[model samples]
Target: MRDTMKPCQHTLSDDVVYKDVVVVGNGPSGMVTSFVLAGNVPYLKDIPEDLPIDEMLRARLSNLPPGQSLYDADLLELAEGLEGRSQNPISLLMDNLLRPCADLGIQADSLIEWRYDVEKEIDHVVLGRGPPGGAWHTFPPQVRTLSPGAWLSLPPHTTDSAERLTASAVAEYCRRYVQACHLQRYFRCNVVVTSVTAAPPGTGAPCSPACPRSASYCVSGYDHKEGRGFRYACRRVVIAAGACDRPNVLPEHISHHALHQLAALEKAAQLNQQHPKSQSRCWWWVRGVSAADAVRLARASGLHVYHLHRTAADSLAKLPLLNYPDYNQVYKMMCDGASGNYTNYKSLPEHMIVEVTPLLSPQTTNTEEENKIRLKKVKLLNLVTNKTVELTVYIVAVLIGSKPDLFFLQTNFDLNTIEIKKCKCNEKKIDEKQCFLRNHWHYLKSVLGQSIQSCKSRYLNYTEINGNIDTKCALPDCNKRDTCTCNTKAERGLAVRECKCEIIPYSNLRREKNCQCQPTNPYSSGLGYGIDPKKPVDGRSNPVAIDKSTHEMFNFPGMYALGPLTADNFIRFIPGGALALVTHIHREMKSE
Candidate 1:
């Protein structure tokens, strides 16, 4: 019955806008994606002398016709055949093409040059919350990027220097890049994407210019500047929206004085203006050794910061002192408390913030300044020592971590949900029911065609990975009916259980139910190793499962993920994901 279902013939509404592509961010990744989709193509130039690029890969590029583009070639065939450390070969190839030998300090000139081709340009729109820079403009004034200014450039526009840049400088640079690349027309600022779902099957009537034969997605959102809602029907949706909008907050209910790390420094500055030269007390809750900008700015704002973090001293000691001088200097200050060059700072390592209580002191005057100093008693628990201490502060800054707000994606659709109609048979006899269901699963697989069989036949071997035995499946999702389990390993005395389900093939529709099972496996969607990209674990090296050649999410055609969501965290490597997406998209458009 599932195989007999026909495609829907619903027509699009007149209010829907049509485009070849819709990019969901305006950050560096989104900017790069837009730059390429806007018709800027990269071609190989004269290979530089004495760079650290791979020899075989360089030979391949050198062999290309001088005017021909590396992008025009089969990037999958070129990149996949070569050996590399990265699981994604195309990402590695693009990175090498953009910045060869960057880590080794050579900073070699880019091997490719971009040229705009009118024929290759596709109709697209960029939706973002702010002007071209995205969230960078919202950072604290004193905040500086972890990457050097030169590393943050979108192609064809380079920064003046390689020095570490301030937040405003980077934000302004990003803004100027849009103008420099002539991409201002394609960007829609102050727009919040509220929902993204598969467009109804037969929405072809209202398509503008021309209708697309490929899969189309519906993107609806609110426009803050226009004070109205907008919708778009696009052939592809690129999720370059980075993972910094929503902060990972503390468990406690936030009080009036508490602020996120990004806004805390600005609030501190405002307090400084209200009470000049006053020694304001602050309690800073941070995780790991990052967040140097907020910590430094908090001290510079005439606030005595009681720094609480979960990082071990040994971790700080392992940092390369020369490369990370700012962080190392912070560690040095931690070592040298209340002494030369570092004052009004205290480091409490291995401590967890237990509770926060707002205290009302005796009011001497009814001034705004008097109310601002209402104390917050922060209770701390030392993880190593199990000792508790309480301290009073004027304000609290929670600077732990952050993730992208992907609620729009979740609300509109379930990424991993698959529809599987329950099999009806007598279930009183357990053994007979198991036999009947197993046979029913085979019947479903047969209906799914040879494509499903080809996928499952390749990876039937049990292999050991990092001391744990699991199925070695190349595809994230497979039709294997095997129950994967491990109990009482001799070496570790640990039990591991990974439930693998027999997935039934059907039309890729959103908001469907999975097979009747206990605790459905997150990996059933074909995402990376069971990692949910929408709400990824903080600091975990979890990349979404994407086609190495195209950067498209597995099982979800016409959808791509870029930037930190793709697990390419550093700005220097993010553009690689953008390049992969554009190459695939451009090829698809050309084929059509």
Candidate 2:
């Protein structure tokens, strides 16, 4: 409710609101419901194939017009355009948006390509992961997870809540097959949502409040000079708001991470000096480390200082995910635990309740550009009993959730209405002994070894762990305490995983000092620093806004991500509170 934040439209009204069903977000879940209903229902017939969808990435339409042919043709072209390229589009259209509406009996127009602008359109910027930074949608977090469903958020919860799975598919369907399709009917491009008022019935037009109904969708309106504002009002609103469409909002605790690492490194130094040179080999042999991975490593090592067994990718570099320290340690930990009985399901530890899937994310997913991965919930499968149970997730689905004016009958003020708090992602622990943020470059330097250098004097430094780090250390805390997130500058934040408000830290083998602080981006623009550098800046080495990781989007046979994105039996996603939603539609005849 700060002036800096935009007023969300999903707030609750004073009246006791009632409807057939009040689906909050317009993302996959809501869209599937509506795409299933749209023209099939008795009243709203001839529903245009051109349902207005938000642009997932900045893209452009070569030719814009009306009707199904153009849409389909353009979509084909777009898909073909992306044939060999591997990048995650901001929005992914689902086939459910095109599925035959069970009631109205109309075939939905599923997206098959990138329909919206890739580089031109501007999304209303907000953190879609972590939590609901003040948003509302059709389903609650619980309903989403239990159904084996998926979602995405930037900062965490945008409980103006909703679904992501189906819609993401449709976004792709349209983009790949509906390019010049007939989108002229349902909406106007660039109509960013500006305001929403869910007052009592008869509050305005028939589509307005007095009716006590909500809107289907409200996006930025359009104007020639200044862009138009948002729109509202829809009977039986089929919201498309999802939890995975928010922007990046990095944690502001680089400092805390440093200190945590410093403590961890100090212990490692003791081990390095005592251990033999052969034992001083780098941590795991994995090659690339992503921002999300670092964060994950940090979370798992909270309090208990967990060391990086090595640095490398789970696949290409020859390291196995199951064999990695974090993976093996967790697997070992899972092995020791007894098979969880169904009768005692409610008492499961928070971590075992996780379920994972391939979906977009909001964390520092910047490192593996060619390896764009999507996340779903983590499910706990009892290795002993072969029984699989759904685990709640702490997801950062905000990036995929926030959109304007869907499920607008409420304004979040009504206390009786379910209070949708902005769930935040987790952050790091600032323990005095190990300040990773203070020694980020130091630890990194240690890991990188010859490939990297160390931070200057007074700054933190990274050193090799040797065999000493792999085993135990002599630190007072190490002797007395359990674990921690070592040199990896990963920490907890506003949203732990899915939007649960809890700031905690992960254990990365809590270290003492050192890192890769040798200036990755120290070049001064248009000046002396550019004299010696010869690398092209168009981004051979520079950071590209869009990640170009492998074609890990659709799970096509030779194209699935080597790891992370794959949900094949071995994965698990966990969270706090999640549920499954069941919907049934009934048609109302106008003649009545």
Candidate closest to the true structure, highest lDDT: 1
TM-score of 1: 0.72
- TM-score: which candidate is best? 1
Residue 392 lDDT in model 1? 84
lDDT of 2 by residue, 236-256 (tens): 332223322221221212111
Give the TM-score comparing model 2 with the true structure, all chains together. 0.25
Error of 2 at 33 (Å): 3.8
* Candidate 1 residue spans exceeding 4 A from truth: 1-12, 80-87, 203-215, 254-257, 312-320, 335-342, 361-373, 411-540
lDDT for model 1 comes to 0.62
Q: How many steric overlaps are in each model, in order?
A: 0, 267
Candidate 1 C-alpha lDDT tens digits along 459-503: 232221221223222222223323332121111111122233433
